[model samples]
Target: MHKHLLPLALLTVALAACQPQSQNAAPADSGKPESATAAQPSQADRAFADLSKRWLEGWLQLNPINATQVGDHRFDSEVDDLSAAGRQKALDFNKKLIAELDAIDAKQLSRENQVDALILRNQLQGDIWSTETLQSWAWDPQIYSGLAGGAIYNLMAREFAPIPERLKSATVRMGKIPELFAQMRENLDPARVPKIHAETVAKQNNGLRELIDQFITSNADKLSGDDRKKLDDAVAALRKAVAEQQTWLDKTLVPNAKGDFRIGAANYDQKLKFSLNSALSRTEIRQRAEAEMKRVREEMYGIAQTVLKDKPTAPEMPAQPTPEQQQKAIEAALELAYQEHPKRDQVVDFAKETLAQATAFTREKNLVTVPNDPVKIILMPEFQRGFSVAYCDSPGPLDKGLDTYYAISPIPDDWSDEQVESFLREYNNRMIHLLSIHEAMPGHYLEGAHSAQFPSTLRAVLRSGLFAEGWAVYTEKMMTDAGYLNGDPLFKLVQLKFYLRTISNAILDQGVHVDGWTREQAMELMTKQAFQQEREAAGKWVRAQLSSTQLPTYFVGVQEHFDTRKAVEAKLGDKFNLKAYNDKVLSYGAPPVRFVRQLMLDQPIE
Candidate 1:
């Protein structure tokens, strides 16, 4: 593996822009219920709005990278203080905010404020729990790596500011790299640091150099003499800091890191609650995932049957095949699809073609209301490579009308022929189409655009991962069901294979963290049952260890979205419109799925 490439997540980067969305209505033109014009706010609404504004201001000040990512350039030159004192300051801020929230009578607030109140309250409390309980600052080195990387990249990546201004921010942040490294070393206890995390950060340590060299030093020519000199000095200092951090990572951190990666049940459950912000329990998630796996597997086998029909070398296909027969039959069908992958060099172009295709199909079918927001396919930056193969990089709520990046990771040059083939087969032509659908067309890109239209900065910033991921996963089936790709069974099979991944992720997360499953056990579930490629399964094993509750969001989110659709359809029956239903659900900014369901169904916002 290339040590310096930092792998990124394929999450539905569900961030929002400038304003607060209405609580009870869809957009005026969305064909769902909307008041002719919004009513003037009540006193309670005014107070809640003021509280939200204050919370965001303080929160953004404390998290400057987040601010920049969210398009709040006021702190573009700042970086987060992740030291012990910094964590305490954040904790105090959150406690005070939560206390103020508690003083407000939620019932008195407008439905929108009520929803934002809950989301904000959860976020504040989650911050507190994360610091006092999970305490990843002490163990996870990736936090520092990600923050330091984002600090520079977020400033320069977008054209939100002028080149010189962004470069100036980069210089200030770059100059602080040595101090940042000092805090990373001071804040971390090697004994409590997990080895995988230590090793991952050691790999990620010098990715800062890539960011500085590519985004900063490379652009120094764009600045005037004095500014350019300052940048050169900052870049030199940043390089030294990167080297020093790498040395400590390789020598002190990696060697002495002896902490357990599995957060265990107690920590897992608490973190899960905060992370999801849904009422779903771990037990409920497991039960649903197990059941859904069986149903989805049966569906995949049925498709496999169609795809493998009359094939001479096809596996034995009884109508009621045993487990072994079913596995072989599905694998055989998938191999045929895997044979159709693009060459390594063609992956990005393939993704581009697939995205355009997904977009056209989405428009043609009218499956959902397509957003007009521009989305561009780009290569994943070197510093953001390994976590997942790709991601949708949307401008934060405060940064509207900018291009949303549909970034695909180029195949690493360092992989062996076998490894590269394994990756290609896992992400074949059909799967790339599915990924494009999920990450771009009518998925994150579409949902993000919809939520970005909502008025609340609070909802935009505290956007729900469950809703975004679930909506993305849900759209995969919706498109396939609408007969995308001329109703090819191969496409349907690959889509189910992708869905199985969601199911397996939930199962793997619990199995590793709660059930104490070993690497061997996790790999079996991914490769054999989930049908993930060796390369994909191996990466997931690492991801499952690093991310605690994140794995289940895809599963739980999609399940609730499914339930929401079913309920809405049943209620509206003959009148239910897919486009209207989709638009209405997303019209409120992307809140937790349950909250979306509540507003849709007239249930208690709680």
Candidate 2:
């Protein structure tokens, strides 16, 4: 969901430093028989190790862009062949691997090996589902646009090789852009294309020119004459291809687009299982979300009363305010928080200051082990806009020592004054502090660093989105519990507001995709119930339409983490320590929450 592509198979070697000690017993003392020291690997372990190596090699060869992104330069000059043949080849390969993996006897494996087998099998199954069932190549134009932009962006964004060397690879990739678009046009059925997908791809295709101008041409001085000429020719060809794609989108795709964006109930259910990697069903998720929404709202009402106690129009503190009173009280208290937001241009600066403070607080409280890797705050690239306001772009596990980017999007010039105001209020000062906590410090930046230290390259590359998001959400409560802002009820109030946002995201995702809720219904849930501003609500409606299943990960993941913590605390009682628990949970890399629980509790992995 984060869109940072890497070949999961290619990551085994990078994980060598982070691998756990083998659970198998050591050889007996010298007094024991010589056969004890000559123990051979079990059949399952031998099969797993051999299969993992072969599968990774095959996968990397098929996905060269992923290889490049993950710091493997073997395929640096190659672009993905997005033809029908390419798709079929990939599908066949996955099926073969799945069959091979299935043939192994899991009961014969070590507990750790068994867990890895499960993780790898699920990953393969999910890939098969996407290609065979979901088939985004048939409807999603954004797929091609992403590939084109990423081909050039990945080379320019990192310094894995010399400028000349990377530029040469970029030139080779750029030459393939026209063919890539041609493949996309041939593969996509206009009748199946979503209007939103078409429009977004058109905008993104046009933005490629900006990526060239800003990143490529701006660095022309570093190139030799031959390399510069190659780049110039590639840019000209790429622009023409992008323009043609845009024309096809506006004139052909948009007019004839009859696709429904929703995947409907059956597809949604299957996808949810793979996406979550959790035991909970859709019905269970909805029930839990609805109950939590009510409980969180009640908790927020109490905080709202406390924050608005002295305000002239504040409601009296009742055991339970009527729904109307609760809304009014929350709006008034939020106004106090929103009054301190940064000016439009200062948001990035404010984020920088907030990160520093968050780092200090995390260290002072010993919340978790903060990584020493540097993080930078930068503007979001033009090609990657139109999504969330900010994201943490950490380096691939294979690309060690590089800086992690915390890219924030600036307010668009086309936005009206009212829209701008709405945006700022939603990301008010206190909320920005919470965002930094989630994206940096003890959030993605820190957790990502720890995950990279995992010795299983397979696990490192196949990091779970649910676990990553869940950990960030968990940290918000962790920081709040540690008395952030000297235990300010106002800070807690804003934290609850964010908690409400996550709850609403899960509801809104399911409501629109599964139940066919209209935009107006979604706006009501976000603005009225979650306290999101108008601009924020509108943007989220677009995001929910663009993606499915991902929105629920935050809620489901955090619940698992919370449950895991509670179980550990109950077991340890007075012996429990926060830092130790945090370190141990993160040490497993970003596996499914269930796997993390098994490893933490020494239970047999299912």
Candidate 3:
């Protein structure tokens, strides 16, 4: 959860969001000094760099799983301290860092340092607030689940280190899994644990053993003598630990879980501010999302008129339709596209096809500078499947040359045929391409590679999900507009439906946490208003219940990006080059869109 130490930049889950990276591509941080050439750094700037590094190192030590994920191996043998003392240790660490950060005058720093200073401060302050105010440790079981899951997943997912070396790290973390779970049980208050979160982690608990078997047990031969013995002993202890935890989870945590899933308006608002780091408020996000939903639906209906004009069973598509009429027309068109989906087992291969299409189009259209970095379309790791359907897992900003995983969940065996059909219908052929674009290509993969080259690890590590997701969503429109898939009206229609999901996410999130919307209410927004399939809508309902504050990033980030593009286009008139504008926007790394706007417009960093 360095989305608890995975570092903020390592994992970007789109709620609904690859290409394979080039195998021969250079290392992740191979680029030369990103900003050392920028106006000679002031003394304060140098000090700020040193302080940022120290803070990062200390923070990683406390969240060791994240440390490994971020490519810092020093803490590879350690795990996070979730006990009370550990929480206090993290609290104290943030407090001291923030105090030191404030002592540096922003006016004296370079523009780069100034922006990084704000990002670091936002992170430091957010940590303190998270521990002291939000205090999810005492309530949300998902908080601990990340550390448990990441403990093994982060170690084995990549070949960043040698088999023997990484296994050794895994050995230490596995030995400590019991302690991690123990601290988890000790810290969480049963009365405050939400049933949804408890149930989610309960499903996630056994994934630890599965990870051990697949990675550690299978690779145990790499070690020898005492090392082999150590690995075996660690595995045995970890298996027993997981069994005990699973028993406790099912018998105790799930049954006794009594907390409300909704975080309410106040918690939602505070977390929203920190998560997005945008100027938009909860009310503004809703107001904007609601308005955008209407606009997008209307646009979808217009496309539907083209794609569905001669089809039998097509809904009435009037020139100026009412809400009911418009909804019908859009759904009819999407159903047509949904019929053209991949089969159950071909999803990953299909994703690769879409990635190639997207990559070629991005290069062909020159929409943005596509990075040649290596990316792979992989099956979603067992430990990571419960959170979202698909995500882009990149190396830590500090880690170099590792491949980024464009991981998608395979259809579960236990699901009914109807459930599989529902899922494929939602992620149809056209929809999967949209996902590939958003998750990779000129979306997260390209954006992340650009971000890693930005010269500042601080900026790279503390990337804004708002900007990242927003940029990904924005590209869905950009690619379609530039004639992706030969400008198929059906493709455009599905693209609009995807955008509607992004908009609905913002609305659905607040609707759940702020207005206390029920499953029916949430489903109505996703299925009826957003035109999501039953499977997608149902899964998203659980996602909304399981978490909050991150959903709106897509909406808020995209809105800001759209505004930035329009402003810059208006300013440049004939001189605006699409490729140049795109590169420059990404050149600032993945800072909030607001700051990127300021930088692009030559405004103050504030």
Model 3, runs deviating above 4 Å: 1-39
Better of 2 and 3 by lDDT: 3
Clashes of 3: 8
**Candidates ranked by lDDT:** 1, 3, 2
Q: 29 in model 1: Cα distance from truth in Å?
A: 23
lDDT of 2 by residue, 1-606 (tens): 133453322111121111222211221111111222256658787788777767766766787776566555677777787788998888889899999999999998766667778878877887788888888788877777777787788778867667787778888888887887899889899889888878877777777888888777788778878878988888788888888888988898888878888889988898888777887788888899889989988888888877777767776667767888778887788888988889988999999999999999999999888878878988888888886888877765555467778889889999989898889998999999999998887888888888766655666656787888888899999999999888988889899999888889889989989999999999999999999999989999988887788889889988899989998898899999999999989887778788888877878888
lDDT of 1 by residue, 1-606 (tens): 001111111111336533322221211111112341267666667777778888777877887777787777778788888877887888888888888888888898777678888888877777787788777787888878887888888888788767898898888887776777888899888989989888887877777888877788777889988998998888888888888888888989999999999999998898788778889999999998999899989888998889889989998999999999999999999999999999989999999999999999999988778877788888887767667788887876777477888888887788999999999999999999999999888888888888877766677777888888888999999999999999998999999999999999999999999999999999999999999999999989998887678888889999999999999999999999998998899898888899888889998899
Summarize candidate 3's per-residue lDDT along 14-98 as a digit string, tens digits.
1111112232222232122445664676778778877887876676677677766666677778888887887777778888989
The global Cα lDDT (0 to 1) of model 1 is 0.81
Cα error of candidate 2 at position 59, Å: 1.8
- Give the Å shift of residue 285 in candidate 1: 0.5
Question: Model 2's lDDT to the true fold?
Answer: 0.79
> All models: lDDT?
0.81, 0.79, 0.81
**Model 2: what TM-score?**
0.94
Lowest lDDT sum, 10 consecutive residues, model 2, at: 24-33
Q: What is the TM-score of each candidate against the true structure?
A: 0.94, 0.94, 0.95
